[model samples]
Structures are given as C-alpha cells and as structure tokens.
Target: MRSIFYIFFFCLGFIGYSQELNCSLVVNAQQTGNENQSIFKTLEKQLTEFINNSKWTSRSVAPQERIDCSMVITITDYSGENFQGTIQVQSSRPVFGSTFNTPVYNFNDRDFSFRYLEFQNLIFNPTQYESNLVSVLAFHVYMVLGLDADTFAKQGGDAYFKQAQTIVNYSQQENYKGWKLEDGLQSRFALIDNLLSPTFSAYREVMYSYHRLGLDVMSENAKRGKEEIASSLKLFEAMNSRRPNSFLLRTFFDAKSDEIEQIFSDGPNVNIASVKETLQSVAPMHSGKWANIKF
Candidate 1:
C-alpha cells in the first residue's frame, strides 16, 4: 500500500514538473536627469502593459495566469552621448506553490545612444534604431526562456526568432503610419523578424567559434574523445557553409581550414527544407514577403 502511494506521488510530481509554464520579455526605460521617479513610474506602467499584452503559453499553471512577470529598470549615475542604465527582468508562472523564475538577465553597465523614439514612432523608419531595439530585446527574452539563441538558430527554430522579427517588419508598413496608441501597441509584431534575424546570425557565429575552440583544445589532448570532437566539427562546417560571412565562421575556418576540411571531406549535404523551415519561423507569417513564403 505504501509503495502504491509513493508511485502515485512520483507520477504527480513528474506531471507537475513537465507542466510548468515558460514566460519571457525584455524591458527598456529611459533615465533622464532628475526625472528618475517619473521615468520609473512610466516604465512600470509600460512593463505592466507589455506583460498583459504578450501571448504567454501554458495558461493552465494558474487560473489567473496573465503573462506573470516583473521588471526592474535602474537609472545609473553615468550619462553622456548615450543614456546609461540597467534592465533586470524576471518572467515566470506559479509552479508547486512557488514562482519558477526565468533566467535573470542583466543588461547592466551599458549605454544607449539613440533617439528617444516612442514605440509608435518607429512605424515611419523601421530600419532605424527601433529595429535594433527589437532585435536586442528578442535575444534577451529568448535567453531568459533558457533557450540558447545560437543552438535554436542552427536547429531551424527561426519561427521563434521570426515572431520577434515581426515587430520590426510590422512597424514599417505604411497603413499604420497614423495608428492610435492602442493600435501602435498591437503593432509590435512588425519588428519580430528584424529582432530575431540578428540573433540567429549571432548564434551561427558562436557555434562556429565553439567548434574551432574545441578543435584547438583537443589538439593538446588527443584522448579528448573522437565522437564529440567530430560532431562539433561537423556542425561547424555545416553552419559555416550556410553563413560563410559570419564573424565566428570566418575566424574559425580561417584559422583551422585544414581541420575543418578533413571533417567535411565527404562534402556538405545542404538541408534546404530545414533552412526554409527556419526562415519561415522568423519571417512574419501575417504580412509582407513572408506572406509569399508558404509554410
């Protein structure tokens, strides 16, 4: 009877663990001189709105689960050509009587040298600072979700990235030029593709770097395991072939062309389907060129 009870409890715990919800976001606030209080309040309001409007998944965690998250925007003493501050965001859903916090990301000790453009103003010039902001925020949110942007990029998770890129893309459409505040808020989807593309690009670079770094590490240690080393080299070559101009790829391949050559001696087998799938993931499904790309 005791064994049966333990088994039942174990299954319950496992189910609970698997059912935990995941939420993510990035918060940006300005730190003007002597207006910290007002700025903070505005940021809090914005943060609240941002959370409420986001599409959080696995809503079963809490009956009232509505994008449960918190954000901290601190204005630093440093100031100059760019506004300096820190953004700390924690996104989570209640699990087992405790909130499972997403990874705490610290965009601290940084500087922002851009125009104080309202989230709505970007609709006029989508390729400007707003696009950059969207991309940065997307990367932050993905990291917080415990999803390595680099790995996901290579594994063809572009749709996840595209959701982020849509924010930028939508902002550029002419129809929303005179959009209202509420409509502007909803238009964030436009920038999703712009935001996520850079992330995937960066991920490709990092993976290539890691492969080269691994090879160098193994050169000193022959018993470093062949299977693992071969796998890294294979992935590196594959990613490099896809994005040859990537900084990490250029650096890695340039430094160890011989090793990489040997690894892919059998030639490369391009995965066109995977690439298409990845592109579709980050491409805005609702508008623009994305509409032409069939899923």
Candidate 2:
C-alpha cells in the first residue's frame, strides 16, 4: 500500500510539472576564448533542460500539444562569469484541424547581459528578476504563451499577458536595459504594454482572425480562410490610420510578411490593388517586400 501511494504521488508530481514548450536551445560561444569556451557546451545542456522541464503554465498540455519553439543565444563575448549576447525567440503553433503550423511570435532581443557560474542552478522566479538570462527567458516564455493562446481564441491570452506585465513590473526594479520604458519604443516594455493596452485591440483581433479563422481553415476551405485573413488585414489598415507605425503593429508585419505573400500566391480572394493600397498605407515600410503581390 505504501508503494502504491508513492507511485500515485510520483505520477501526480509528473502531471503537475508537465511543461508545454518543446524548446530547442543553441548556445554559441564563438566570441569567447578556447580556454574556457567548453563551459558554454555545458550551459547549453543546462538551459535546454531548464526551459523544457520547467512548467510555465497551469494548462494541461499533452505531449503532442507542446508548443514548438527555438532559442538561439549567440554569445559574442564572455568574461569569466559575465556573458553578453543576443537571443532570438521563435514559436509556432499547429493550426487546428490542419497540418500547417503558423508562426505566432518571433523576436530578436539584442541587449542581453547576464552572469553565470558553471553548474549553478537557474531558479526561475516569475515574480522577481533573479538573473538576466532567466528573467529574459521567462519574459519571452510568457510572451510566446500569450501570443500562441491569442491565436486560438479571441483575446484568449489575457492571463498570459497580465503575467508578462508582472514580469515587466518586476524587471523595472532591477538595473537592466531591456526592461526600461526609456530604452526606446522597440524595448520589451513597449511590446507587452502595447499588446495589453485596449488601444491595440485591433492588433489582437488580427491575431485571432489571422490564425483561428484564417490559417486554420485554409486546408479545408481555402476561400473561406483566405477571406478571413484578407478581412483581417483591414484591422492593420485601421491600426495604421489610428496609430501609424506602432511598435506592435510593426511586429505583426515583421512576423507575417513572408507568410502573407505566400498565402496570396494562390490568387486569394482579396483584391491585389486594394491590398497594395492597404499595405502602403498601414505598413509602408514593408512596401518594397509587398511588390510581389502581382494579382
């Protein structure tokens, strides 16, 4: 009976700690010298286990349901315990009832600075900024969750966004660069803050429609899905008219630019000239890329 009880508890613990991210981590330490560069190889293994094993959400994510994402940290310079580099975070979710996986979030953070000692455990305290590397990873984790959730349901990611906001609040207490509002409009603060604000509802709506209604149904009903996506583009048009060249809006285009062109390659239901007009009006900076809209 005691063995049975122990097994039950073990299963319960596994369920409780089931993480949702299928994350791949690559730690590039080319900038550092060969003397101690082998340490980065160790760091890579540790970071992978830390991110993949740590449960970031309470949702019961099945093994197959784990979100697919990758983190590339290019360590350009390191000194003993100090490390400096950039991290590129990318995540994509499988569309419902389809084989297609759409990119949900992609961000390159350039202002990463952290300290790490070999064999030290990374304690991820969500409510506090314990270390730059963990804090940054935690922030991006929440952002990815929020963005992925928003794609499935209308404003479904509010809880995750609020959680990210809490991290941002915690980060402000520390002396970091990316966590500051004065860091510039492209800072981490701008990204989440804009996402949560009521003013960006149109952008969030685009997220919802572009995925759940648009990409998800493409295989089953191409016309209907294309209509959903094309109609959703008008939201960006409205956003640009209301708040031109917004940070989050630019992020939207940055993520979808290539996919957008591909989607319309089938001669979608959208009017090409009208599409050009909207693209030029809302996200004109990407106008050169949109030149291929030859419909």
Candidate 3:
C-alpha cells in the first residue's frame, strides 16, 4: 500500500506542474557579422528552455494540450550586453476533430531591445520589471495565451490579458520603446491596449465565433461551419464602421487571411458577399488574398 500511495502522489505532482506552452524560439545574429556563433547559440538554447520550461499560468495543461507557438528574434545590432532587433511571434491552435492547426496570433515587434550576458538567467517576475528581455517575452506569451483562450471561449482570455496589462504597467518605467504610447500606433502598447479596450470588444467576439463556433464545427458540418464563419466575419462590420481600418482588425487578418481565403474558396459555399466586403473594408491590406476568394 505504501508503493501505491507513492505512485498516486507522484502522478498528482506531475499533473500539478504541467507547463502551459510548447514554444520554440530561434535567435538569428547573422547581421551582427560575428564569427563567434556560440553566444547566439547559447541565447537560443537558454531562452528556449526558459520559455518552454516556465509555468506561465495556474491552469493544469496536459502535455498534448499545451499551446503551440514560435518566436523568431533577428538581431540587427549586437554589442556587449546590448542587443537590438525585432521579434516575430506566432501561435496556433488545433482545430477540433481535424488534423489541422489554425493560426491564432501573429505579430511583429520592431522595438525589441534588451541586454543580456551569456548564460544569464532569464526569470519572469510579474510584480516588477526584471529586464526588458523578460518583460517583452512574458508579455507576448500572455498575448498568445489570451488570444488562444479567446478562440475556445467568449472572453475566456480576460485573465491572461489582464496579466499582460500588468506586465505593461510594470515595464512602462523602463526605456523600452514598445511599452510606451508614443512609440507608435503599431507598438506593443497599442496591441495590448486595443485588445483590452471596450472599443474593440467585437474583435474578441469574432475570435470566439470564428474559431470555436465556426472552425471547430467544420469537421462535423462543413456547410454550417462555413456559414457560421461568414456570419462571424460580419461582426467586424460594426467595428469597422466605427474604427475604420483599426490596428486590431489588421492584426486579426494577419493571422487569419490565408485561412479565411481558403475556407471560402473551397468546401461548401455560403453567402460571403458581405463578409468579403467587410474584409476589404477592415483589412484592405489583405485585399490580394481577399480577391482570390472566388466562390
């Protein structure tokens, strides 16, 4: 009975500590023109381990249920401890009853700048700003978490977004470019601010309706799914009417334009004339992809 008790406790402990993200990170320093590649390699390895191993939330996420995400950090300039570059973060979630993974969040942060020493420990402390490196990463991670959760349920990501907001609050005192409002409309501050704002609530609603109500039901009913997807896209009409080509709308299409195009071009055809119009109005930059949706 002692052995059985030990096994039970061990299993419980494993479940309790299950990490939330299956993230892959790549560090590119080719622009630095440094012959010594060891520093970049170490940065990649350490940051990869830091992000994948760290538990970002209290939820018990199984290994298979972990969110799939990737980050590409390109170093444009590197000297001593100071590194300046851009990071492209993307995340995807698996569609229900399908072998496909749908893109969730795709963002490029041009203001990524930080200091790091080789083998330096990377830790995330939510209450205070540890470093721009850690704060930037943790903020994006929460954004991915929040957006992914939004796909599964209506406003289910509020808690995660709130955590990201806390990081923003803590990091604003630093010299980071992305954390300040004056950085630009496309800055990280704008992204999170737009997400949490009541002005863009339709963005969250469309996220839930498009993925959970639309894509998740595709395998079961392709026609119904396509119809629901079109209906969900209509939610953006009201948003676009007020904001007219907002950053949040652009962000949504950045991750979903291809999928949206493919969904309407193939499978069962539904009345998408209005959705296509809304897409062109809100996400005109993706007009090329939208134009290809011949259905």
Candidate 4:
C-alpha cells in the first residue's frame, strides 16, 4: 500500500516515445518440459520481446501514459513442440493525484495451450488467423487497453474492445479452444461479449466513477473520494441485483476486494457497516474480508 504514491515527481524526469504496453513477462518451465529443455529459454526471450516491442494500438501513446502489465506463463505439460500451460494476465493504471496504481485486470487463465517451435518468430495479424499463442496474447493486450481506457472516459475502450472482437471473430476459423460461444460462461468469449453488450453498460459507468472519481481523488480529497467509491458500490449492488452473478462483477471483486479493504480500513468517517452490508450482499464469497471491516 505504501508504494501507491503518486508519480507526479517521478514523471517530471522522464520523456520519450514508448509503446502502449510495458509488459513484464515470464515463462516458467520447471514443472513441465520435454526431452530438450532449452526451448523454454528461447521461448521466454522471444515472448518477452514480442509483447514489449509490439505496437498494439495505432494511437501513439506517450511514454508516461503507457499501461503497466505483467504476464506469467506456467507450463504444466510439454511434449515435442506442443506446450500446455496457464497464463496469468494482470494490468494496472495510475490514480489521479495519487501515486497508487489501481489494479484493472487480474486473471489466471488455464484455458491456454499452444505449440511453439524453437527460435520461431511470434507473429500476429489482425485480419487473419494466427497461432493460438499470438491470438491469446493479442486478445489480452486489447483487454488491458480497453479496461484502462474505460477508467479515464466513459466507454472510451470501444475501439480496443472492437479489436478484441475482431480477433475472436478471426480465431473462429481456426481450431482454437477459447474463442467460441459454446466454450462456457467464463470463457474469454463471455468476458468481451459481456463488456460490449448493452446489458452491462452500468458496469462501465461504475468503473469510471470508481477510478476517475473515486480512487483518483483520494490523495487530494480522501473523504469525498471514498464516498464516491462507496456510492459506486451501491451501483454495483443494484447491477448485481438486476443481473445476479455476472462474470464482470466477479472479475471486479476479484481484482478489487483487497484494495477496497485497505482503502476503507480507518480513513473514512462514513458508515462502514452500511458499506459492509452492501459489499456482503453483492460479493458474499468475500465474507472473510468484509467480516473484518467494522469501524
């Protein structure tokens, strides 16, 4: 929590053209590897370079405004050129007037399996089908950009989400596993589908309020900022009540539960019990955290 300082001072010293995503990547192959373990090392280097060096969006993002994200790929099984594993994708954005970087997306996806040849260049084409590896990485890249854009402006991520939709549409012609409607409710299809759906418009509004109005204002006005966040939770409660359990809501609480607890620990003079009740009603799975939120 202490590291959540504003970067106002830090940003003053840096200026340059930077890519949209500053993604720190890791490929863990200790658990699963075929006869030749050397391929994993090459895989790590190529993937790292691929993600950091690729220009995801056409818009030129300034150096300081680039998104901060991490990708961890853990191999559970490997044979020949076929690698099986999970990928953890997470991203954060800086809060206004504060040094804190708020978590926008954090997910551990087990629905990934791709084949990689040693020293093969990773490539992505938007208009055609690519390998599952490139498609998956590209999908999350848009998601990160989209979610980050939503915080700053209302439905500002439409272009990025539309890009992801294009990837999903193109992947349907391939034999991939994560891009279909029949892939179940929590599939990647459902995530972007729900976001782009008209039914979930309120969630986008809550995102803007929670980040731009709520957390961003904390350093300058803690009480009002906290109130805005608390009010947005009421909006969350209403949405959850209307739709019941949504993948977006679950994803929201997943990324935000701990931060919500930390922000309200002892700073606000508002009704903590009311806030607790609202949270518990919407996210009962996090009862353990809300249970400790008194006063």
Candidate 5:
C-alpha cells in the first residue's frame, strides 16, 4: 500500500514539470467601468489556469526549463459577453550559467476583441477556430515558445512559428480585426507573416547570435561575449536596408533596448562605433536608450 502511494505521488510530481510554459496572465477591466468585478476576476483565474496547465509542446520540460512569460489584457470596453481591448505579450529565457533571464519577445496586440461567459471552458483547437480569446492566447503561447527557442539555436523556432502561422491561417476567416492582411501592419497576421518570410531571415540570425553566442557566454568571458553581441547588432543593418522601420525591428528592441544598454554600458571595452551607428539608424525610436550606451 505504501509503495502504491509513493508511485502515484512520483507520477504526479513528474507530470507537474512536463508543461512548457509558466505564464502569468492578468485581465485588467478597470477601463470597462463595470461595477461588478467578479466576472473579470473569474476570467483571470480561468485563463491563467488554461495557459499554464495546457501542454504547449511535444517535448518534455523540467520546471526550470519552462519559458517564463506574461500577458496583460486591458479591457477597454465590455457590453454583454463582448469584450474589446489590447493584450500585451512578453516572454524571456534564462541565460546560460547564470541566474539572469534575457527578454526575448515583447508585443502589444491592439486589435483584441472576444466574447466569454464566466464559466465557459477555454479549450484550444489548433486545426479549427474555436473562439478569438482561445485562438489569441494559444497563438501568443506558441510565439513565446518559438522566440525562446530561437535564442538557443539557429532557426530552431521554425516549427513553433509555423504553429503560430497555422493559428493565423485558421483565424483569418473569422470576423476578427487582427487576423487578416488588411488589419494593419502590427496585427497578428503581419507578425507571423514577417517571421516566416525569407526577406526577414536575418532577424532570426540576430536572435541566435545575440543570445547563444553573446549573452550566454558572458559569465565566463564578458569581453568575447560583448564582442559577439555587438557583432550581432550589425546583422540588423542589412535587414534595415531592405525593410526600414520594420515591425520586427521595433519588436526586437521593445524587449531588448534596456538590456542592450546595460550590456554595453558596463562591459569589457570593445569597438562599438559601427554598431552604435546601426542602432541609431535601425531603431531610431530607441534613440534615447542608445544615447546612454557608453563604451
């Protein structure tokens, strides 16, 4: 009897670590002006459970190996079961041989709208359109997985990004704002489109170089790591020359600007003359942050 109990508990512990994402989801309804807050609270709890408990990948992951991510859904208006809002999704992965986690992806999706009842089951269907809420959440979950995977290997995120693309394909036919080509440049459609296009291939290279060759090696050899990271920044120049002021470029900097500043600010001295120029040109919006990169 004791052996049977020990085996059951061991299986439970093992299953707990197999899920891929450790996501914190916050559903903010302050702007809605709805006095009854219980529904929002219930939505947050259910969505949190849905995202964190669902197995996102086929690969087994230990607790420490799960990708750390977040979603902030700000409800701008609500009427009946309809919700209109924006969702900010961000994710990060741990640096090798260190306690630090480097931010990998940050994106604000502004065209979010959905319908939900308090106790409706949030199930994700990859092959078909279920609900905009489930589709959007699942889409970002795969995106976070893909982006985190890219940081570890060259083009390692292909499969996951393809998964996100599939979600886009499935959701476009629905009467949603962010899932079609005409839905503006920053839509979920545009994001997945740009990621899969061959024209933006260099972006993935930069991701691999900046994380694997650069930040991951910093603990043991800060100078070499800094140089690798600096070199990675130059890859963006060619990308910028082709498509200047791209959504992908802004997305990269959104997650990395502060980290880039801190990295070059206090590091073993390396020539960043050209890289600094590249930064000013490719991501001018982050000019203020770049101004502080002393090296």
Candidate 6:
C-alpha cells in the first residue's frame, strides 16, 4: 500500500511539472518627428493603460509576471498638415514569441482644423484608438498561444494544448470580451477584422495544423481524442470550403487524401514535391465545391 501511494504521488508531481504558462509584451511608439514632451507623454500613458487593462492571456498570468515583452512607438513623420507615427509590439513567452509592427494610424490637419491648433494637430484620437490597439494586442496573444499549442503538441506537449484550449474558451465568453481595458469597445471590434484581414490564409493554415495535432493526440487513445479531432476536422473542412479562393482548400484537394496521409505519417520532414503531387490530385475536385456539400 505504501509503494502504491508513493507511485501515485510521483505521477501527480509529474503532471504538475509539465504544465506552465508565462508571457510578456513590449510596446513601442514613435512620432514622425520631434514632438513636444506633452504629446509623447499622452501617447505613453494611453499605450500603457491599454496594456495594463487588456487581458492578454487566458491562463490568468499577470502582465508583470510575463517573461519578456517590449513596445516601441515612433512618430515617424509629422508635417504641419499631417501626423504619422509607428507602433511596434513584441511579446515572448516560454512557448512562443511574436511581433506586430505597423505604420502610423494617420490623422490630418483638416479633420482637426476647428479645434485648438495644438490639440488638433495631435492626429489620432487616443480615446477612439485605444480600443483598436487593445484588440490588436489581445489577438496577437491569442495567435501566439494557438501556434504554441500546435508546436508543442507536435513536440509531445499535451499540456500546451490544454492551455491553448483555455485561451479559445476564454475568447468565446461574453465576460471575457468585457475584460478589455475600454468597456465601451465592442467585442470583435474592427481591429480583429482589420489586423487579421491579410492573415485569413494563415488562420486556415493554423486550423489545419490544429486538426493534425488533434488527430495525432486522438490516435494515441481513440476513445479519448477521437471526438475532438472529428469536431476540429469538420470545422476546418467547413472553413476551408467556405473561404473564397482559399489556397489551402485548393492545395488540399490537389494533393488528395493519400498524399495528406503520407505527409502526416512522414511528419514535418515531408517534402514539397510530394505535397505538390498531392495538391494536383485533390485541388481539381474541390476547387468550387464546399467540403461539406451534400449530393
């Protein structure tokens, strides 16, 4: 009985040792040219507030506890008539790292023409812009977590998947949406649509990675993982089929199931030539058809 008890305690310790969550973010801001101390100070305060208020992670880790993060904002160009700036955010955690860099969100003198010239020249409305910034920052955190889950799963980190799922579950919650620094900003704010617009393809790619990871986990124990993989694959197929001109669906079809299986079986070392061959076979059939379309 004592030996059995010791074994059980050892197993518990192993589980505890395997789970972890930590992250950090840096914000950088700059103006087009030298600006008054007051303007710079205002921008710094707004950026800091957004970071402090936004719940960037689902794991309940505090911002101060984040491992490494940096943000730099540069006012790149400020003509008397127009103000331009740049904001770059860099984040890192034990499992992942990412950077978001963008040109200044611009505002013109004409728009501020009526206000006191000093205040008018400020360009972007900090109050209005705060929500958008928060959205971008928050989503970046989500993406990093999602990708980390995939990477870790491939490398045999089941705990990471649980962490990723926590993030996904949190994002779907009404209360979580209200956690943003700016209460007035609606959930799924325009920033989600804008910052994520060009990366729609990348989203689909991640879905595929997630599906593969799910399948691998499920394969280890069919009864335990099967339902989750099936659900994830169904969602991926539906999304790929619906997207207009989705390169992934086209590529998937062109490659065919056999090729896909081979790629999966071969793991990450699978070559592009084999993938291309599979793509050629599968793409033709599914080019215009939804993956879920019924006969």
Give the winner by TM-score: 3
Candidate 6, residue 163: lDDT:
39
Candidate 1's TM-score reads 0.33
TM-score of model 3 vs. true structure:
0.97
In candidate 6, what are the lDDT values of residues 1-295, reduced to their tens digit? 9999999988766544431223233222233335554655655565455554444433544333433444554555555434344344343333112131111111111111011123332222212332223333444344344433443344332333333333333444343332233532222232233123444434434334434544345435433333343343344443544554354343333323432343234333323343333333334454233322211
Relative to the true structure, candidate 5 has a C-alpha RMSD (angstroms) of 1.7
lDDT of 2 by residue, 98-195 (tens): 77787888898888888899989898886777887788888999899889989989999898889888888887766778888898888888888899
- lDDT tens digits, residue span 54-127, model 3: 99988988788999999999999988899999999999999999999999999999999999999998989978
Residue 61 CA displacement from its true place in model 3, Å: 1.0
lDDT of 4 by residue, 136-161 (tens): 99999999999999999988899999
Winner on lDDT between 1 and 5 is 5
Against the hidden true structure, what lDDT does model 6 obtain? Answer: 0.37
Q: What does the lDDT read for residue 193 in candidate 3?
A: 94
- Residue 46 lDDT in model 1? 49
Candidate 5 lDDT, 1-295, residue by residue in tens: 9999999989877876578988999988888787358999999999999998898887878887888999999999988899999999999988988989889989999999999998999999878889999999999998999988899889999999999999999987778999999989999999999998999998999999999999999999999999999899999998999999999999999999999889888968887676688889999999998888776
Tens-place lDDT digits, model 1, residues 143-246: 33332323223433344454434434453443322112343321233222312454335444444333333333444543342233444444534444565444
The TM-scores, one per candidate, come to 0.33, 0.91, 0.97, 0.91, 0.96, 0.33
The window of 10 residues in a row where model 1 has the poorest summed lDDT is 100-109
Ranking by lDDT: 3, 5, 4, 2, 1, 6
| Cα lDDT over the full model 2 | 0.84
What are the lDDT figures for the candidates, one per model? 0.37, 0.84, 0.92, 0.86, 0.91, 0.37
* Candidate 6, position 35, lDDT: 55
Considering every candidate listed, which one attains the maximal lDDT?
A: 3
Number of backbone-clashing residue pairs for each candidate, in the order shown: 25, 0, 0, 5, 0, 34
Residue 27 in model 3: lDDT: 94
